[model samples]
Target chain A: MDEVYLFVTKKILFNLVSRPVAWFDRHIVDGFMNLIARVIERSAYMIKGFQSGRIQQYGYVFVSGTIVLVIIFIYIW
Target chain B: MNILSLFVLIPVLTCIGIVFTKNMKQTRLVSAIGMSIQLILAGLLVYLYLAERQAGNMAEMLFTYDALWFPTLNIHYTVGVDGISVAMIALTGIVVFAGIFASWKMEFLSREFFISLILLATGVFGFFISLDLFTMFLFYEIAVIPMYLLIGIWGSGPKEYSAMKLTLMLMGGSALLMVGLLGIYFYSAPDGGQLTWNLLEISKINIPIEMQRFLFPFTFIGFGILGALFPFHTWSPDGHASAPTAVSMLHAGVLMKLGGYGAFRVAIFLMPEAAQEQAWIFLILTSISVVYGAFGAIWQKDLKYINAYSSVSHCGLVLFAVLMMNQTAFNGAIIQMISHGLMTALFFALIGMIYGRTHTRMINEMGGLMKVMPFLGVVYVIAGLASLGLPGLSGFVAEMTIFFGAYQHTDTFHRILTIMATTSIVVTAVYILRVVGILLLGPIKNDHFLHLDDAKWYERLSTITLVVAIAAIGIAPLWLSDMINVSLAPIVNKISMAGFEFTSLF
Candidate 1:
């Protein structure tokens, strides 16, 4: 009886608490870093193309950057 | 001239003289002389305070100077020093004096710089001596407002943004502190007591528990933010990184101390009942800051950022030790403030001198500094050792006493937190060694730095003063501990007298 109770309790905690904590640490923390990495990469690629007169999406960069910053500030405030 | 008034008045008058000065050399000279005089006066004041304590006059403030100011709000311009206050006054003197010398070569707006610096010193001096809450609050703001111009104008690498963020965060903290102070004034005399701004008198009144609960968080978090309390400590790293050397020395060294001092003198001392009930919230956060800050420093390449994060770690100990609610821990807390102030000042001073020569702060980009600038390298080692809590240093005694007092508690949970805090020491040691090994040892990274000159004469003088002070306190802490414990006794008594077993609150 004791062994069964311990196993069940461990299962509940692992599913309920530990899983969420691990998920949050990865998705939220690493996801933010990954997103930042992606933005910088894309911007570098776009700038290189624009210097060669091949890319023409200047307006999108400012608009998207402003929107992201706005959302962050709103969350912060 | 009252001694307490001299502490404030000298700096004020010197600031005026600085404003009228025509050139940078004259400005630095005048401010340097003024700060030296303040240091002498502060030393004398500490001596007198100690004599009074020895003669059994531990009843109230040692030397209080009173005058009528702002009569409309029932506030009096009062100033005095207990054992702790006198010590802090001396700390301000040392930091400001050393700060002037450290910035001896500053050419950019040097006249304006010295003037603002001295003015800020006056406000800090006034705040430490104030017995009236209203006067204290006024001086606190006076100390804070100068940072905007100082950093925003003279600082480097995104100075304006960092300055604005620091000023806004600190002001928000003050707004919260104002609300708490007002609540205390309103609910002070629930039993037909008279209204007053005198802190000592207010402590005698039995504030209702409900009000204390509401007020304590506001006061703790309010001051805690300035002390670089965790979760709210983000501004400090950027601010310190952007600030000039002398500003970093003062900000990390003495200014952040105002937060810890205010938290203890006003927040915890006035509302012991609330402290008993709510200390756990602080302990958890402080423990996290201790560990988190250490981990944060481990990866930083910039010299100032590492020290800034280290400060967050060390300053967290001040709050953590205080919340232990034991005599030994409180003693350790005060010593930690003094210890950290001197050590961090020395560190920043050396960093400034070294960086001036190398023109780079990246650890990976510099090596064999001990070969070229041996004096700076040696002092950096000493400061880093003191920081990592090496035995026979000030940090060692402070940390040991804190641990001793912490475990004296009845609870096992706090011990677990204490262990976590203790593990941070290992992380601290690892990073300190890593930085030392990388920066001070091995061959020179760039031949450009091989011919670099070591610390100048003024820099040498500053290091000798700070190192001697650090060593003296570490080796012979008995006198300092006695003075601190004498003042701490009354606070512990008031808390114990509340008849609340603080651990039982859990």
Candidate 2:
């Protein structure tokens, strides 16, 4: 009777807890992190293209940002 | 001489002292002593301010001293501290003190490094106490120009490119701010009088609405860029990743708070009508920043990049709460600035220490650090928990007050935005725990990591100073909150007095 109890408690219950916990941590949590990383990295890469180290490109951004602000002011006022 | 000026004077004197030192030891020792005195002065200032408040001093600004510097332009070297500035000064003091110790081992041009670092700190101290716009702008530029030398000389990982990018972006922001300030100056006397460049003087008389509408965007976005608002935040991750440990700590901890403080003090307080009208546009941008930065942090494997992105998210929350324009939210904004400042500094310091030992910042490359370096690992966990807004931590107190204040707007638009902003909390928890599990727990991935030594005495001192501050705020937030809440009354009244007919952009 004691052997049966040990098998049920240690083997069956322990597997139930450890296996699921490990599975959840590995599959759900880690996979989610990986998936999000890929998605954001793609966007970050695209954004990086606009941030070329060229002095001319930076000038364009400054000019364009000023233009956008001016337009907003005109529209709202 | 006003006592406030000493905050800047001591740092300058320390730089002079460092320049005369013969060896690295004397240089750092002098720098440490100077900053320690500065920190003690800050505590004294706080004590005096509170005691004065207790003695029924209801003046808007305490300990003000104004003197003309540029008479032609009506610019003065004015200095004062209300409760808010006092808090910011204290934050700067603690971070700079810890920063001196954190870089005790710097060997390349050690004297020059310490001098530049103290100079940078001097600008920050001056900026906080100044009430005149011209002097504030002067100090603001003084603070920013040192980063190029700091990063390009001593930094790692694409240091040159990162430094150039950071300097140019910040300079661009300053150019816009200059235009906005000059515009405000031109309209300073709408009733046709002499123009002045004092913040309190400008606030006393309302700038005409047409001019306010035109200049508000420039001022807000100028400071907002530094506060890491959305697309403009690109420089932060790269810059922080490349900067040396102490530079990253001071830059993240004390410097970025400059933006939020300026936006609240100069942009919003002086131009309440424009802020009330145009709040929607900035609110959307800040909300995107709040959520997107959290998601961005989750993708980064490098420890510094992870923390830099988290700073974007946290600082974005500061701007968001400021825009809420209520006493409670404003109080929350100030607290968030301090909390984020301390924790992010701790994060950068820990990352530096860990990188120094393991020689790599990639999480996947290191594992089970707890087995070898138990002290740093445990502190890192505590920092992570604080950042994720666990109850009994500074993060929780700040975020809860912000959300509660924001939800007071009974309109559907605010309700929806509030709910959207609230989702970032869960994302923050996910990233924090994932890093903890991967970096501290699980099996040892590198056999070499087993033999690494734990934190040194100096490193322990730096981290523990920050940790104690984090816990102090977390455990007993009420006193700080009440102080901020009292000072916020006038600003909140000014903001609320503006008519609220512009909630919906469409």
Query: How well is each residue in B304-394 modelled by candidate 1, as lDDT tens digits?
Result: 8889888989999888888888787787788889899999999899888888999888888889899999989999999999999988788
Which stretch of 10 consecutive residues in model 2 chain B shows the poorest summed lDDT?
B497-506
Runs in model 1 with CA error above 4 Å?
A: A1-77, B500-506
Q: Between which residue pairs do clashes occur in model 2?
A: none
Over B421-475, each residue of candidate 2 has an lDDT whose tens digit, in order, gives 8988987887798899999999999999999999999999999999998999999
Please list the Cα RMSD from the true structure of every candidate, rounded to 1 decimal place.
10.5, 9.8
What TM-scores result for chain A when each predicted structure is judged separately against the true chain A? 0.52, 0.58
DockQ of 1: 0.03
Candidate 2 displacement at residue B357 in angstroms: 0.3
Report residue B364 deviation for candidate 1 (angstroms). Answer: 1.1
Question: Native-contact recovery for every candidate?
Answer: 0.00, 0.00
